[model samples]
Target: MLFDLARPLLFLLDAEVAHELVLPSARLAHRFGLSGLPGGPLPGRQVNAMGLAFPNPVGLAAGFDKNAAFLRLFAAFGFGFLEIGTVTPRPQPGNPKPRLFRIAAARALINRMGFNNCGIARFVENVRRARYDGILGINIGKNAATPIERAADDYVACMQAVYPLASYIAVNISSPNTKDLRELQRGTALEGLLDALGRERRSLARKHNRRVPIAVKIAPDLEDDAIPAIAERFLAHEVDAIIATNATVSRAGLAGLPHADEAGGLTGAPLRARATEVVRRLAAALQGAIPIIGVGGILSGADALERIDAGASLVQLYTGLVYRGPALVREAVAAIEPQAARMAA
Candidate 1:
């Protein structure tokens, strides 16, 4: 109701400006005990994955809270978990302004923000300040200036830094905004990168006396045949989970729409089929060997169930929150509870 009232006004501003305004404003509302401002909590069943118990299966994906500044604000919206960052070892301004575009007609978004973040140091400090004890997933990425060949070094550094703090660490090598980052997803590159991170995790586990799980995020723009092989690599490397997709570069159904030709990832309603297809394929390839975190195009309860039906152990909301507002989270949670119960039965 609140969001429906605010949508027209928010849509009146530039997409990025509206985004910058909302997070802080919402945080203020949360601080004032305006609990109903985000949305009242909905019932959710517990889901266990990656060795951690999720209060619910709906999560806020990374990129929303890149700096980890609004943890509690989003937590109040009732996500089972919140994944923050795509932060690098150092700060970056990201791509120039006007990078985030809204396709209102299609309920989708295109962004080439290029992982602009406050760097891991500030990110870690912010996370510490939030003191949020929910199931937190920290997503780490290499700096844009870093050479592609040495991306593993950046991932390792980020892994070590957030390992102790994260309920699970998400290794993001799939964002199309970064140059050559996707190359790391290929054969030898994937193996080499996983091998390095595997070594670091073993060490971090011993040092922290806790083995924090690592989930590798991949891009949706991959050959159908490529998924099985990628699944094989994940299984071989013992990756705790696979975030079936990041945003996509393909502009399949948006040929004549505004921002249809943007050079970054396309997410929201348009991404539903592709993202779910990837999850379906990963589920088939993984054959329950590893868990899959399905995201993209989940704008309603039915969309959430679609991902689950396709074998996503969990689903996440981003662009959906933009179009549907906070109510989407509760809707998704309510939609999936029966399925979760059936599975338990």
Candidate 2:
């Protein structure tokens, strides 16, 4: 109600500026205990995946709270978990201003903001100070300047810093905004990167005496034949899960629309089908060998459930939150209730 009314006003600001202003303000409200998670069919939606218990299957996707600074507030909004960051080892400014563009008619977004973030060190500090105590999944990525071949080094560095703090660490190798990052998703490259991450995860597990799960986040633009091979690598390397998609480079559904030709990954309603298809493919290939966190174009309860029906153990919201506000959270949980009930039964 309130958000819908405020949507037009917020929409007046540049997308990125509105994002900058809204999060901290919302965090302040949550900090003061003025915020509350809304209701639907979410009360009994607890789920256990990757060895962690999630209160619900709906989570706020990465890129929303990249530094984890608003965990307490975001956690209050009814997410089962939160994936923060695509943070690199060091801070970089990402791309220039006006990098984020909105396609209001299509309820979509195209961002080539690069991986703009406050860097791993500051990100860890933010996580340390956060009062929220839910399942926190930190997403790690390579710095824009890092060579594609040495991407493992950047990812390893971020994993080392965030391992203890994150409930799970998402290895993001598929953000189209970064140069050559998606190359890490190819056959031999994917296998080797997974190997390096697996080896490092083992050593870190010993040192920290806690084994944190690692999930690979992939792009949605993959060919139909490529998914099974990726699933094979995931199993061989023992990855804890696969975040079925990041965003897509294709604009299949947004023909002749504003910002349609924008360079960056396209997300929101336009991405729902493609991303769900990836989840479906991955599910068939993995045959339950590993879990999939379905994300991309989740703008409503039904959209969230579509991922579940297609075989996502969990679903996440990014662009949807931009379009629908917090109400989308509870609705997603409600939408997924039947699936959770069936599993429990």
Candidate 3:
């Protein structure tokens, strides 16, 4: 009800401006003890994955709270888990202004906002201040200026900084906005990255006396032939989970829509099928050896279930939240609860 009232007004402003306004306002609402959604947290079936338990399988994907500044506010809205960042080793202004675009008609978004973030130092500080003890996943990415060859260093640095705080660590090598970053998803680059991160995790586990799970986020734009090999690499490297997709560079269905040709990744409804297919492919390749966190274009209860049917152990929302409001979280949990029960049975 509140979101419906505010949707039209929010839609009235520039996309990024509306985004900036919404976060703080929502945080304020949370601070006042107001439920940010129509109801408070939804009842969900517990899920055990990555050696951590999730209250539900519906999560807010990375990018929404990139800096970890609004963890409590989002938690109030009933996500089973929350993933924050794509934060780098250093702060950097993202792509030039007007980087985010909303296509109301298609219920889609296109963004090339390079991994603009307050660097890992400030990001850690923000997380520490939030004191949020939920099942949090901290996503890390290489600095824009970091040469592609040395991206592993950035990932290791971030993992070391957040390992104690994160329920899991998500390695983001798939955002199309980062130049050549996607290359890390392929061939020897993929091997080296997994190997490096694997070595680091072993050392960190011994140092911290805890084994934090590592989930690799991939792009949805890969050729069909590439997925199995990617899955193979993940399995061989012992990746705890695979985030089945990041945004896509493809503009398949939005041929005539506004902002359809934007250079950045295309997300929301336009990428739904492709993202699910990627999950399906990963599932086939992984054959249950590894769990999958399905995301990209999930906008409703049915979409969430579809990802689960395709073998996603969990589902996440980003663009869906933009279109459906916090209510979508409840809807997704409701949709998945029965299936979860059946599985448990």
Candidate 4:
């Protein structure tokens, strides 16, 4: 395939450099109407979640198109929906140069790119310029410099701006790269943040005349004892949905591998099982109270199905897309379709 030929060359460059190259080219390709995207789900793959009808349960996770730059490229790849950003109220340069790493042998990636993105002002502008018409979810986060106590203000500001632009707004309190961001996931902090967002959503709904569902993206690195209380908080707070995981801080399965010692979150094959386990536990605790968007290390059709089988209402791909390519999207659609059809029935 074309990507197969390009993979070797892409792998040869610095991970971030290759990424910087791919998106602009993809945007240009889409702009010219030149990409022959495979398109969306086959007949029976549709599944509704978070009050939206997904053409398929497969989606491109946030971070891939951090700036909302290539909806056309992804839509052509046939994603049921796409989540973009981890964008903040103000633009950030992220951590530092060479922040992205490749674990080629493990089919994984590790990144400490703190939420580097254009400010919400420009982010909304970019979303407004995109022409791809599928569902778009905007993932929001706090600026690195924001004091942990004041994080909600940043999230609230970003949420208010993105509410009209997003089909659903994902609050990312879990990514490990940002300083103390995960602390927001703790007991009172988590509860207070959710409560604040819940109140904001109510006001925004009245103002915009729409209640854009908000999903919290949690960390996979939670201690075994914490999952239940987290789930309880979600239910009590009436959070619309939960993205069971963000990339993990653990380097669990990559023993002695290259880039295995990187400082950022680990994602891909090593993360699949841990991520699926979170979905399983969340599903049990949630008891179907709210939907779960499972994402972490899906790399194949079977991997995608594993997340759903474990109770994720929907699944997303990021690291996998790097190792596999757009073909993986269609493969995921096919793999989940039967089970999805049964659920739909």
TM-score of 4: 0.95
Candidate 4 C-alpha lDDT tens digits along 93-197: 888888999999999999999889998998888889976668889999999999999999999999999998899999999999989999998878888899899
CA lDDT scores, all candidates in order: 0.90, 0.87, 0.90, 0.87
Q: Report the C-alpha lDDT of model 3 over 184-264, residue by residue, as the tens digit.
A: 999889899999999999999999999999999999989999999888988889899999789998888888888888789
Of models 3 and 4, which has the larger lDDT? 3
Candidate RMSDs in Å, in order, are 2.5, 2.7, 2.5, 2.5
Candidate 4 wrong stretches, greater than 4 Å: 31-34, 39-44, 338-345
The parts of candidate 2 lying over 4 Å away from their true place are 32-42, 338-345
lDDT of 1 by residue, 56-166 (tens): 899999999999999888888988899999999999999999999999989999999999999999999999998998889999999999998899999999988898899
Against the true structure, what is each candidate's TM-score? 0.96, 0.95, 0.96, 0.95
Total backbone collisions for each predicted model: 0, 0, 0, 0
Better of 1 and 4 by lDDT: 1
